[model samples]
Target: MSTLTTANPAYKLELTSSPHIHSRWSTKQAMWMVVYALIPAVIAAIVFFGFYQLIIISMSVCVCVLTESAIKYFRGREISIMDGSGIITGLLLGLILPPNFSLFGTALGSVVAIALGKEIFGGLGFNIFNPALVGRAFLQATYPVPMTTWSEPSYAVDSVSSATPLSAMKFDAVFAGKTEMLLGNIGGSLGETSSLAILIGGIFLIAIQVVNWRIPVAMTLSVIVFGGIFWLIDPAVYPDPIFHILSGGFLMGALFMATDWVTSPLNSKGMWIYGTAISLVIVIIRLFGGLPEGVMYAILFMNGFVPLINKYSVPRIFGEAK
Candidate 1:
């Protein structure tokens, strides 16, 4: 017979690594800060795509948060829907999607992002891939035709073509001006169209140290080197390096998705390698492969190598001998 004792649980000490200084910041703070940074791009999306875009964005966000919460509930774990990471992931996934993408597909992608991409790996810090990109990859595989379909922005006239700049280059042998691409008067994904908006937001994040600057810089440099080489080889056969850098999802991938804290490599050297490798893959895929745009695939491919890069590029211990 066991006696029932009304005793409270004993307190236990938790042990961890060094550098115990606790900052005022937290995961929620960082996530929300990123959300704030992405606001300009969201605004740009609405301006260019119209109100329906907001509906898609809202649907994605709600579904993502709900899916995360449901998974936690089923597993009997603490709910983390309020943390803002899901919102950011959903927003990013939606931003990269075409404005006219089916809402059901968008919601399904959000669920996959939260369930398989994040929760299956035990949530935020432990995930191997960027959740947004994971959702996008799934969507691209399942709905290739819809994913590739392009629509004109609201500011364009009825005569304007519905093809994205990259698509125009790939199929129609035409190129949009730098001015249209930069200002986002051209057709593309919701958030990726406006270089000006993405730059404003991305620069803000880098300025505040929310995002590492080395990744974007290295990627941009590699694009310049490889793309310039191709352009110089035959200007008539290839678009200019400047055009490659500005068009498609390159800026959005470099600034936001590729720099994801959970997926990107740690330390400056590893980040440089990661960024450069991703850029090279993008250039190769766009220039030599069947795809017109390759940012999504390139980032996902490099994400698999982050662990190896981190292993090799670990920073030297302070005061350690050669």
Candidate 2:
């Protein structure tokens, strides 16, 4: 009989490894904090794109959670839908997607992100790739027609024939120096356009200690420094380094994707090199390579080399064997 008693209850519950796991910090709480951190971006999306932003975000999250749950059930594993990882992945994916994307495609993206991006790599912390980017890349590769056709923040379906600013830069040289590119009035994926929103959220995460400050600082500095020299030499070709720093998806990738704790280098020196290399790759891709927005690919490319970075770039410990 389970009865309430002041002195002694009818039974004493046994506890295990996770008994005291949640001490003021929970995965759910942490995820919600991430959601809270995303509030500014959500507001920006809604203010620009209207209430449809909410619909897209909701669909992204719902599909991700449902897919995750279905996987757990089919695999005969404990339910983990409440942990909020699926929610995070969905939100990140939605933010990166073109706002005018098909709902079916969005759902498929969530499923792919979970099943291939995460679970197949042994789930969450063990994944070799960023699940969100994996889904984005998959869609980009498979459906270049819809995936590349970006639209400005518009409520009309007929007006969805815009190209992303990065694509524009890659294709149209005449439209390179426009303010719309930096201020996010241009066509692109929802979150990638607004460097302001990404910066605000990144700062919040850093202030709250939810994210480290190293990666963003190093990467941004590298891009600006490298791009600055070139821009100073020829403004006709290179936009302001500030524009390069603030435009497209650099902040979003540096702050969110490159800073993934599991995939990024653990030590300080390795972190600096990791972030710098990513930034250099981003610049190379944007300037010398084919891609206009290189953040996602740069992070994915470097994530493949994290283990090697960890091994070689690790600073010698105090009084350690040489």
Candidate 3:
């Protein structure tokens, strides 16, 4: 009888780690997309403020890119300024600044944003706070007068007060109409005046899946629910919920800064908690605190708790023991 020969397998199994599926977008793509999303705000800033605002924006971006490049060179790491993180930080800082802020101060803020806010903590992905906010906070402490000064937009009419909406409400008890704020006719930071422009960019980001929708939704809801309560208690004393949503930097901060992938929470549950806490703090500070605006402080404060939020909020692996 003829013996049958044993057959060898056609393919061999190879073991691999998790993350079997990969995203099509790279770090550079994500960073640049953020820059793209902010472009509408940048253009709106220039349109509302003036061409001088472009100079400020340019100065901030150049300084941020240069600072990051210098640090990378000194550390013997390959310079990756083109990766777009520096551009984003600078762009954001520029957007939030006073229209005609001194170039020197703008440069200093950009330096601080990249150095202390970013590279000191090991660069882009590792920074604890939003880099732009860090720089803004520094400038706020160092140059209080310049940072607080507001200017009338180029197209502003005599009826449109130069005082920022929040400032007007807080100090003068003057309510800037909802129509003016929505159309960006109110005096405010370069990029924060227009709810319309911010909404366009924010919605684009959310639609592209670049941003988590939960944080913004949670933050907006928190503001409406809490702000509404105060308004109902005394409409004369407290501004309405829509005013809270459209005025100041609430939309910009909720959509752009607080949703930062690095500083924000990871899981869905954690995002809701983080967003709610931020909005609550914002409400407290805006209504009762000495400051007219509290978005920067609110976002930075919540950034500190992201690690803890992630730790407890991670979902259990499927089919694993409790």
Candidate 4:
């Protein structure tokens, strides 16, 4: 038998396991990049809401970090708070909450986000649902009245009882102008109100290749196509597709929540399926369901199917026998 060796005695082929391909990208680096991307939304939230909203964001982040540290310490794991995942979870949860949501409530949600949403599932890479959305859902279910309470932009005066665009449309038969929705002058969640801010952050993430472009594109196209169908059928009854894109949590969830590295599918085809299904559910719920918004529910619902999607959607190896 011929022995495999290099011409140079020191040079020899090394045997390694799979994943022969590697990138310089680290989980810490990616997590911090996501933090940077969320800055615009944070700034926008401060502008649209009041300076007090900063307290909510700060408290949430602190709580999340502390909760994660505690859990990791109890489990005898190395502290990983500096990795930035906890901050991202806190920031996302704060952004989705109603303006001026109680600090205690925000803290409670933060603990659940870290303890139940993440650590309970074996931490960061193993989480099945976006931790932030989990926190939001918990808040929504536990405190429906406070969670649904909306506030007008800080600039608005003499506006009584601010209602989200979706809620206004669904309950009062009132439609907010597209300009108001686009500019985020209308009432909604802290970060979700400003489609402009979200687009700025989301596009930056895609540009840096930190976020997969397929998920957001698939979601946007799906919403446009499905939502457009209903609008075309009865323009007078349904708001235009642009309205759906600009209002509620669709943009935020599609770009940030649904695109979570752990919870989302592993392949391009699976991404399309995941994004489309979430959008379809959102349209159905927004148009016909009791709740005015469904982005959180839709994304979480699809997250459960990501494993199956990945299992079946895996690409065939080149030249492999079929």
Candidate 5:
């Protein structure tokens, strides 16, 4: 009998369907890819919000990793932060936050995200709500004033931060101009300031095939459809669809947060429904609700219903009756 050695001529390499799925594009890869996609936004934050943004992001990530590690350690379970889910959650929570937010608040948000959003429902892929959005919502509810407070950067004389365009529009409709909203020159959350930067990151994600384009597309369309209706009713009061799409957290939330594979729906039809529903909730809240911005809450809220959407929207197999 011939031995199966490298030198033996009988050696055969068995090829399988999933053979190439070794370690190149795994869960770890996905986590790292998300981080990679956010680098541009991080750079944008640093430019627009200053270096303290980096500090906030770092501290938030550190807290999340430590919080999760400690939970596993005290419970006599294995270290789980290595999976990088904590890292992704940290970045997402950090990026959505305002630049000057206190370190303690960021840490609290991280804890809420990892503990309530992730660990309670089982870590990583098993979670129902998007962890980062959970943190965002918690912070928004607990610290309504500070969370909404925004400061514009000064290229001119010394100036203080001001409310963002969307926030302003939420209160009064007269401030929605063409240039201010388009260029993202207003003050807002660290990541939501720059629609240009967010769109760049979105393009990279779509290029890598890491995110499903369907969700963003559907979400954008839904926003336009809903916003357009209001604009038609009162063009003077309601901002145009372009301003609606660019201002606030719509692009940032739809492209980066809402498209999270683990939390969002799985099927193509489900993605459209998920995106559309979220967009509707966001528009409704921003238009009539108390909160100036509602993208984060809308996403987390709809994330709760994703399983049901996936359960029903799944296309039946061919020749198989439902």
Candidate 6:
């Protein structure tokens, strides 16, 4: 029999998956890191929307925490609210909502996010779609009027209530200037208001390796290329590529939502494919479809194919003879 260890043994062969050297990281660590990275976007939302926006965020978070805690208590599992996943879901959901959304509605969305999007699907790692987005989609379906009724950004309060850039482009051929969209001075969802802030958060996440950079880069480039083609062909109707990239939830969706580890693909190749497909779907819906924006739908639709993407993209065994 061959000996597996030496006399001075400081190492051992552990049978596991590809990542044999397990780091000291845990789900809690990754979850909290993501929460910390979102601070910049949260601050920007508050600044743009005011103290009232804070209340909406607080309510959503509180309700989400409570909902998850209750589920765990009933399921005989240790309550893991401190894990930060539920908090991230709540914050993301709240950030995507209109700032003036009613408190009760926001709370309801939080409950759905935790219960349906997460717990019903066997909780965090098992969920197939991004939980926050699932909740947002439910809200959109149930409350279309409220979901579409956006409030103006703080800087433009003196101006009349306005449609979002995508909506304007779709309905009136009106183009929102790039500067306001970059600085987040125009009307949209709480988080989508500021491209600058979302970029800051995205950079932090990428720097810390909290998210894979490939998905965002791929998605962004696809949108630019696709949108640019349409714009060059018919500038009279289609807005420029920069507008599509900066407006609405494109940055937030590409960076934070679409990159959810549980929902997105596993391999680099699959990630590029997923990102490119998502961007194409978004442009198709925004340009030709009835809806003005499509990030949420695009992400959720692609999420369904993640399993197939992973299956086909798996690496072949090394040094194997066929």
Model 6: per-residue Cα lDDT at residue 104? 88
lDDT of 4 by residue, 80-103 (tens): 888888999999999999998999
Which candidate would rank higher by lDDT, 3 or 5? 3
Instruction: Name the lDDT value of residue 273 in candidate 5.
Output: 98
Q: Which portions of model 4 miss their true places by more than 4 Å?
A: 1-24, 157-161
For candidate 3, write residues 210-245 as lDDT tens digits.
888999999999999988999999998899999999
Candidate 1, residues 190-307, lDDT tens digits: the string is 9999999999999988887778899999999999999999999988878898998899999999999999877998778999999999999998998888989999999999999999
Residue-by-residue lDDT tens digits, candidate 5, 1-322? 0111113335465433311323235566666788888887788778777888899999889999998888777867677666677898898899899868989899999999988988787566568888888888889889977887676754324332376777777775655555554455567788777788788888888888778899999999999999999999998888778888988889989898999877888778999999999989988998899878888889988988998997899778899975
Give the lowest summed-lDDT range of ten residues in model 2.
1-10
Give the TM-score of each candidate. Answer: 0.92, 0.85, 0.92, 0.92, 0.88, 0.91
* lDDT comparing candidate 2 with the true structure: 0.74
Residue 88 lDDT in candidate 5: 82
lDDT of 2 by residue, 179-296 (tens): 5555455567777776677778889888877666888888988988888877788777666677677667787888888886557877778888888899888887887787678888
Pick by lDDT: 3 or 4, better one: 3
- Which number leads on lDDT? 3
Per-candidate local distance difference test: 0.87, 0.74, 0.89, 0.88, 0.80, 0.86
Q: For model 4, what is the alpha-carbon lDDT of residue 93?
A: 96
In the predicted model 3, the residue pairs found to clash are none
Please list all clashing residue pairs in model 5, or write none if there are none: 151-161, 152-161
Comparing candidate 2 with candidate 5, which one achieves the higher TM-score? 5
Q: Which stretches of candidate 1 lie over 4 Å from their true place?
A: 1-24
Which of 1 and 5 is ahead in lDDT?
1
What is residue 53's positional error in candidate 1, in angstroms?
0.5
